[model samples]
Target: MTALDVPGIRQVGADAFTWLSAHRDAFALGEDALTEDGHVDATWKPLGELAQTCASVCAVTTPADPLHAPAAALLDFAWLQTGRGELFPRLQRLEPFATYPLEVYSVFASAGLRHPGYEAAAATTARTRGWRSVEQDPTRRLGVLKAERRSGIRRPERAAPLLRRTWLGGLPEPWTFERSSGYALTHVVFHLTDWGRAPAGLPAGLAAYLTHWLPSWLDTCLDAGLWDLGCELVVVAASLPEPPDPALLRDVWPRIARAQLPSGALEQQAPQDGADTEPDFLRCYHSTLMAAFAAARTVTRLPGADGPGRPPAHDGRHRHRGPGEHSEHRERRERSGPSGPRGEGVPG
Candidate 1:
């Protein structure tokens, strides 16, 4: 993949972060953000996503890397927006049975911006039967479980059964893929791999399955100008146990780079005549964030990458055993080494 233009990929992340930093205030939660009438999608969700993306950038890149400082700054900005991690507890109190607050706060927690009050309250909430029994789509369940793990409240026994229920966990027929399923599959991978920090967290069989099919899905997204989903697929490829085909990535990266506007923003699709008056910032923010995430993830995985931090410990609860894959074989792989959508489009 030396021919994959690693610098170009790095540029994509740099440019996207620059854009996000310029428009940082646009992510501020509104007055009703924590109120019962608040629209989580429009308010807390975007800010949380901003925090999560910034956290990913900081986690994967060292301080010396150009992308690191701005990302760190943005993460700090996002934490402040939550009142230095104070708002989460307030939101949790208002919706004690709800999980979004915990989900959102987990990003900050993972980045070391903990809120003792919120964590205490969340731990209590998590132990309740209501919290444990809340039904969610399988893909979403994986995300909640991940959030629990990140927040130090995870119930280890729950993860394996949840994994088995996900569509990707089953390794369903490849032809069943579609837009909705596409999003589901990408998220399943994200949660299982802890957003690419632990590639071994994904079963070897699933890695092979994605490696074989991601190219075609990526091409389709590129052809349709689906920047949001395309960036996600790029992340999936980069997250695999082995990097994807150099040729596939080499071809795909430029198309995504070109999709980025001069402002560093990327839209789900090209704007059409008289597109609704939704602010351009709102329309473009999520895709831009995804692009940065995809770029940062891909670059850090390249040979001789310089991040000082190693991947975090893989959550053994996340590992799946595919047909005929034995416990010993899985353990051997473990010894080898670690590896949105608001607004802009679908809810990721």
Candidate 2:
């Protein structure tokens, strides 16, 4: 049986919290993505993503573990950093780079954690403004369409007519939505799930398209060593109203497990021959978290399946690998929401 690397999950989660905690300031409200200039204005969105991962790791991990409290604290710090939510004015100003409307804050809200400073007004305002921008000029609204769909505030009224039809139509392939970041196309599916809010936003056509194509998508991403994106898709697959193909889910595990490192960091991607970049913990963090989240939940409601806390059987994909085969040595690698009470389901 091959099951997920539970210890690896724990270590990666620990490493992420440690690395992120030490470098949390790097993801401060306004730090530049490429240059990472320090403490400027707090307008960026990486922190929101970071906080989401932290909350996610905490949610799956046993609460008795030592890292649980620290993970929860990370969310708290982020909430405080936003001045109880005032910094979003600055955060929204940056736009489309690392932040999204509903998706950003929803990460915390879904987990039922508290961020007293959460600004419903800011999220709503961003949603309202983005809809107007899409209406006035439809040419560059791909990003806007996605943000509004994910904003969770409401579908942008202006784009609503187009959204149900031509907006995101015809993406019948895996490579169709490659905008930016590691998980471009996968996130389209994610946003539809409202960050795992139950695929409330997934259009029937898109869902049908995914049902036909998702298994292969998982394979291609795995074969390509895009671990980060693959796991995101795993979560995407899990959120589908019907379960994903068991064969597809079974195939992804060993590839991910084999790539894991002793320290618990899963390499950000599969290694290529003579690849110069070394596997780094920071790079491995997101992928590792996703894997843990999948392992923690695959055994439950996600796709209405479960694969947690135990060993899973191996398969053909677990072929013998030579040294430096996949990432050549990189391997390895959540939460609550803000508000009323601890959430009861997947953290969207």
Q: Lowest summed lDDT over 10 consecutive residues: which window, candidate 1?
A: 316-325
58-132: candidate 1 lDDT, tens digit per residue: 777666677777877888788888888889888887999888998998988777777777888898888888987
| Leading candidate by TM-score | 1
**What's the lDDT of the predicted structure labeled candidate 1?**
0.76
TM-score of 2: 0.60
Candidate 2 lDDT over residue span 127-180, tens digit each: 555535534222124334444443344543554454444324545333442313
Per-model C-alpha lDDT, please? 0.76, 0.49
> Candidate 2 at 321: error in angstroms?
41
Candidate 1 wrong stretches, greater than 4 Å: 1-7, 272-279, 308-345
Cα miss at 6, model 1 (Å)? 4.6
Best by lDDT: 1
